[model samples]
Target: MKKFIGISILALLVGFFSANAQDTAKNVTTKVKESAVKVGDKTAELASKGKNAITDKVYKDKEGPNGETIYIDKHSKYYWIDKKGHKVPISKNKLISKQ
Candidate 1:
């Protein structure tokens, strides 16, 4: 009886780990395609790891108040990302023109 119960638990754990294996293999491109939002002439995906925002696009020349180059997500939301990849909110004075 103990042998049977031990095998059942092991099988259950194996099944659970197998199922989760697929989830952990999710790639960046897959995530981008999942969250792709179109904005004007550009498209951006809001990929985040915790509080950190991820961007597939190269950092542009647009500068914010603190002189950090700005980034625009697919939602057209502008932010200044920091060294730690945290999306820092910009001030209203740094509002980006839609034009």
Candidate 2:
């Protein structure tokens, strides 16, 4: 009778530990999924902002000092224009207006 009782107790302990491990694994999976969703949302927001920025920077080129032409984008960083209308990088401080 004593041996039977000991075996039953051991079986119960094993079942309890197995159930607890399963619950822990499920919790970990849920957390990982939540984190993935948040990261995806942030990426989408950044992409939307980038698209809007490009659309807002489209502008016409005009002549500047010493025959060097400047292409001005009211919403963008400073860019210079070549004879072929290609844009060249300029200093941000010179291009951007101080608020």
Candidate 3:
């Protein structure tokens, strides 16, 4: 009778450990899925911001008041032209120095 009781207790202990391991695996899988979703959202937001920055640069170069033209040079710098058709140099140092 003592031997039978010992075997039953061993079996119960084994079953309890197996159940606990399965619960831990399930929690880890849930956490990984949530982290993957958050990373995907951040990637999409960064791509959208990059596209908007390009569009804004193009719009600034093309749109202006009547008889005035805005130009962006190869160095990604900006300048303006007036109605008098004169070549005016805008000071890049002054523009960049401003906070």
Off by over 4 Å in 1: 1-61, 95-99
Q: Report the lDDT of model 1 for residue 96.
A: 41
Please provide, for model 1 over 33-57, each residue's C-alpha lDDT reduced to its tens digit, 9 standing for 90 to 100: 6555333113222233222334434
Segments of candidate 3 deviating more than 4 angstroms: 56-99
Better of 2 and 3 by TM-score: 2
Position 70, candidate 2: lDDT:
40
lDDT tens readout by residue for model 3, 7-92: 99999999999999999999999999998877877676556445434543432424343323344555666555432333244544
Worst 10 residues of 2 by lDDT: 58-67
lDDT of 2 by residue, 1-99 (tens): 999999999999999999999999999999999999778776765564455346445323333344343444665565654433345667644443322
Q: What is the C-alpha local distance difference test score of candidate 1?
A: 0.57
Model 3 Cα shift for residue 30 (angstroms): 0.1
Tell me model 2's lDDT, rounded to 2 decimals: 0.60
Candidate 2: stretches off by over 4 Å: 57-99
TM-score, per-candidate, Cα-based: 0.32, 0.55, 0.54
lDDT of 1 at 69: 57
What lDDT does the true structure give each of the candidates?
Answer: 0.57, 0.60, 0.57
